[model samples]
Target: MKLKQFIAVAFTTLCLGAGTSRAQPVELTFANALSLPQVEPYQRAVDEFNAANPDIKVKMINTPWVEYWQQRRVDTASGKLPDVWLFVPGFGAEWLYGNKLLPLNKYTDADPTINLPDANQTMLKYMTLNGKLYGIGYDFNGQVVYYNPKLFDEAGVAYPKDGWTTDDLATAARTISKKLNGNGRKVWGFAGASAEWVFEGWFRGFNSRMITDDGKYGANNEGGAQTISFFMDMIKDGVMPIPDQKDPNAQAQSLFIGGTAAMALGVGHATYIFSDAGVDFGIARLPVGPAGQVGTGLGGAYVISADTRYPDAAYKFLAYITSGPVLAKVVTTGVPARTSAWGKLSDRMTEFAGKVQGFEPFNAVKGSFQVMDIQKRVLSEVWNGSKDVPAGLAQIATEADAALAKAAAK
Candidate 1:
């Protein structure tokens, strides 16, 4: 396809997948915020979808993450939003859902290929309100603890294992930081932000939550704070680094993948940083805390838009990108979302690392995650500095309760 024709089709279908209806030609626009330094894999999937569905055109709009929200807000406010788009479950999901910019409960057909073994109908219950499916898997990611094997050897500490607890992680950090590298310079043993979702994994590691089943915030929230406190104590004791802002890092990825930082509580998709850098990395389940191996967050869901001039066109494009071949391809890039393709994805990822030994650590702890509310309000405030976590969480709970109450009142 010529460049102009490709953009024409993609813009029309918003760059949907292959399973779309060829009989009906539809056009849509897909707005995405995945413009990381690397988007080749995403581009490949888009190209595949465009090739498969020539009639239903899908255009890919890339936005820098830093400025994406600003651009999206303008688009949404001006009613110029694309027909099909990529959205994080937080603000973006809430913005569309709240404004009625999305078509819900329409996409109920089971995508058998959307492989999440632990996922069932009940899990999809809230994804559809008043009986509608608002989203599908654009990309899926899982949370895990990542560490540098080289650091472990330096500390003379036993490396982390599948069933290791938070205390075990803290213990290791304490030991390693206490011992100086050749020149006695202290190296950080573990690090990550105090974000709610990040901490949620920690709390889940300890078996707790910031919210109750009826959409309430938990008592001892800031799972990351508690975890950080323990980690900071290690820092004070020479185990971790005091999270300073002067050059305060925003995330643990750069430090860990750069190999100076020893450990990080991060997502499965983070392997890209390491592989690209030729770093030696390893994974373990979220270190266990008091609750005996907890995990509580899952990411990714795909959805179409009401504004889309070409609705069915987008679905077709969506199918092509998320199905067999492309799905496998996504794995080679980073963490993949589908369960059916796990064998291929695992093999592909392992091979990408030149048959590295520790990639399966994530696969081992895959069973522990639970679905969080698909609400953006709470997630944003908690994860994205909408407010301080404890205060933000409390505020979020109150807001959610009010929203739920209003729904009940209706």
Candidate 2:
């Protein structure tokens, strides 16, 4: 072979090698606000996904919930949203309606391997907007009463059961407080927090709607007044903690874990926290009001950005996290959104059998609503006793109606 023939052959080989190296895997960014124990399940899912898909690389970005939304707003305005992110139904509404999120129907419908129909129907409804699915719910959190068994035993008071009413709750709380308050160890019947999401259960128990069907404030009505008055009476009766008694930083969970309170209304996550704390705790359904048992469901979903450069890759990651196998692993931290995943979750809970109770009540919660910022502000003022419930709720209706009207006009 001559020198010219050798050079030509070498050039061809070099071009082929460059083309092969250019076929690299796509990289995607997945952002979430989950921390610590709750985050472990998510990290596990991400690791499994990365291991399974060598052609796609997923980078997990963890942010605190407070800063997460603020940063998302900034990212949205500048069109720098991550390929995938975790979002609650209410907060994610703006992004979905603004066309900033990718509609997941095409991917979900075409994928035979994924049993999308097995997901919790109520949760799936929340993730849908304008007849299109925007995201897939990974887990759900619902309200339950976390009570100390030792406290109840010490007071000689029977533990609360399903169908117990507000009156019963007050009686039990009063009995527990009275029996346990004699010593230096101060004990309260209940620890109340200022979060509106938690109080919605009480309002619903009275068969009241916080926001009317028309989207205007409705908490000023008969049921709302009754619910508010009952809580206020409890506070006056010395059964529930007052605003000044609660530490701003250490909320209900901390109080319960410290054994300072006999009972507290908390989310499903409290079961895991209590179990980890080695507290002899039990869970019960929220005490019923005139109507029946009711509470609010809180959870989030995995979504893909509309502006993502790799739609297929992003969808794959979203589906992977919400799939039955992955969700089963995460369900121990919260309720699974997939009905099939519940079986595996039950198996996992065996390790925590007698330590935790009231999981059924959390799973039974099927209703939920999105409370606006203005609504939260008014409710907070009322809960803190700085404003009268009727007056504050009426003001909320007026302002909320005006805002809705203005938006409608635009």
Candidate 3:
């Protein structure tokens, strides 16, 4: 499909250029999961950094998110790794952290510019192995609800507010679905990337979770059950489709861009894509559940690969990427990762400014922790499966116990 959005940022200032200084260049290799507009900004940042210190040169390597892992694993086995790398901390992180990634706590203590105290604790919580820090963050993403404004106006439903409940939003989504489409049109009221992330919002709204505090299967817990039942209710209400294509790989952004679905739970990186479509859209916090409001978090932080030849240089890259200058480029096109930079791009979401009818409900809901517990993969064997919903949840918990045990045994 044609790209629904072209990143609006200019590359002139953010492009790679010559290294400054009279010293020999110390080249560093940076690796990321995929090609994104951030690449240019990163490249630009490298140029600026290199200009200040002519001794350092940098080369960036790009790989698909899916394929990135396969390459990393192969590289790890052979002892060839990039200097600066971005990788998740749980399932994949543990592997590299165990064998290859350098412990970041060492530099965190020695580097004055690298403030371990100010570093987002949530990221540290995930990247730290037992008790030591081992990574730096490139971006921090905040998620919200993205909806079509034109559809809402035609549906004649009142626009959603920040404190709006799930039921209220679902009613509106369903109602809008019926009204906006001509008789027998195929438009869906709401759709998204996956049921997992949406359910993450649901559990948070209800002030609950799919796993226990100690990371046990609590999928059958009252709160977890409520979260699941709510989606099933949405399916019955025609606000959501039956669990047919819950593939973790399916994208929520595509659904909105293609206009196949009216609303979705979206993260910060999406605004660039959605806004590019020239369709009217806006964002708000995820809807409130019967219990409360909630949100989930994810990251693309910097980690010092154990295979990195220059640990100091990689650590320098980590700190540089999270600074204010780099963040300006990130938040404008993608989501903001730093507390200082959070909400910087809210004004640029043109659709929200023009229509005044999108994502208001999400804005009302309070934000919360986005944990990186290593349990989702085990749970997905059921959630992303064709098994009966309730039974699948029960089995998720059981399987979680088994997986944790297996991990512990090692």
Candidate 4:
């Protein structure tokens, strides 16, 4: 028989047999960096999807965050990528440019039921590459200052407010340190991590473009130099802790939680950690810098692999997982990307409703641009005080430009 005739006959046979014997469901793999403890909402969403779609089944794979990137690199090289995975736009740009992941425009545009339009346009813009949508942001977050109210009251300094400038932060930190330090207490006014994300927030505050609008390295410019110099001066002036050369995040968290530090720069989730640690803390906007009160938003996205055998099913699953109702539950650590889901998140924040302030500023600021990967090491040198700010940023520009050029060539 001809191929068309055989297919017609096979379809009829399957239809006739459908009532008597069920067909095997299409199987797809979904992978992410979230650990088991943090994946309850995702698992629940998957369960609901599986229950509703008897013809498709999704298996979830989770890898530790520390090892996920390296493992994904190997998986991409071998064409072993899972059907769906989680990614960060800033870090996943090279992979998207290389076509390791599928462009989601066709899926999003063709599906009338898909709610991609409801996502924050600013965040959606970040997930786009060369005018093609590559992924959907699952959550949004940026930097905020978490302060100890008891410390503020004890030191007779008012809590930092939304429009406070960096100089104001320095003054508060200095006052707190002078009043509480010595006398065997060693209280620190501020604590910050040496991580790239933290530095990116400060850079944005100064209106510095780490990677210029045209995509060349520009971290050695005046704004960038001023940001680095300001933070280094904070450490030298004995207001902020000299961040640990290694594991700066852990050190900062320890100082803040142990009551040795009165203030710490952190993302939204810090509220929960401080609450759990029994710290009487309140949130505040990041201090306004030379440019204004601007900062960067860090978030995650859901991406599909280009080589998936089940593209249509994968797209359906993607839409299901990121839908407002599902994402409302999925977002525990950060703000949901969908405006519709914000109410659900506000409900979750009930524990600290009256105590915390400045969350409004985080929602208002959007990430300006993704920092180049090379900025981390060079900025670390400046933060750790081993290299002069000017010299380190100059080296950063050269190294970052070379890296960008090499990636472009690829």
Candidate 4 lDDT score relative to the true structure:
0.74
Ranking by TM-score: 4, 2, 3, 1
lDDT for each candidate structure: 0.55, 0.72, 0.59, 0.74
Candidate 2 colliding pairs: none
Better of 2 and 3 by lDDT: 2
- So what's the TM-score on candidate 4? 0.79
In lDDT terms, which candidate is top? 4
lDDT ranking from best to worst? 4, 2, 3, 1
TM-score of each: 0.64, 0.74, 0.69, 0.79
Which one wins on TM-score? Answer: 4
Between prediction 1 and prediction 4, which has the larger lDDT? 4
Q: Indicate the worst ten consecutive residues by lDDT in candidate 2.
A: 359-368
Q: List the residue pairs that clash in candidate 4.
A: none
List, residue by residue over 28-57, the lDDT tens digit for candidate 3.
887777468656766777678778766677
Could you give the C-alpha RMSD of every candidate to the true structure, in order shown?
11.5, 5.6, 13.9, 5.9
Cα TM-score of candidate 2? 0.74
Model 2 scores a C-alpha lDDT of 0.72
- Superposition TM-score, candidate 3 onto the true structure: 0.69
What is the per-residue lDDT of model 1 for residues 1-410, given as tens digits with 9 covering 90 to 100?
Answer: 69999899887786465546455556677667664634677777777777776776677788887577687778767877777666554445445346544554343355554443423222233244455656555344445667788888977888888777778887887676666444855477777644334445455544455444443434345563464355546655655554433222345777776666788766555666566677787876665577656554444445566676666666666655555556566545454444444566553254332212122111111111122332234434443333454564455456645554453343
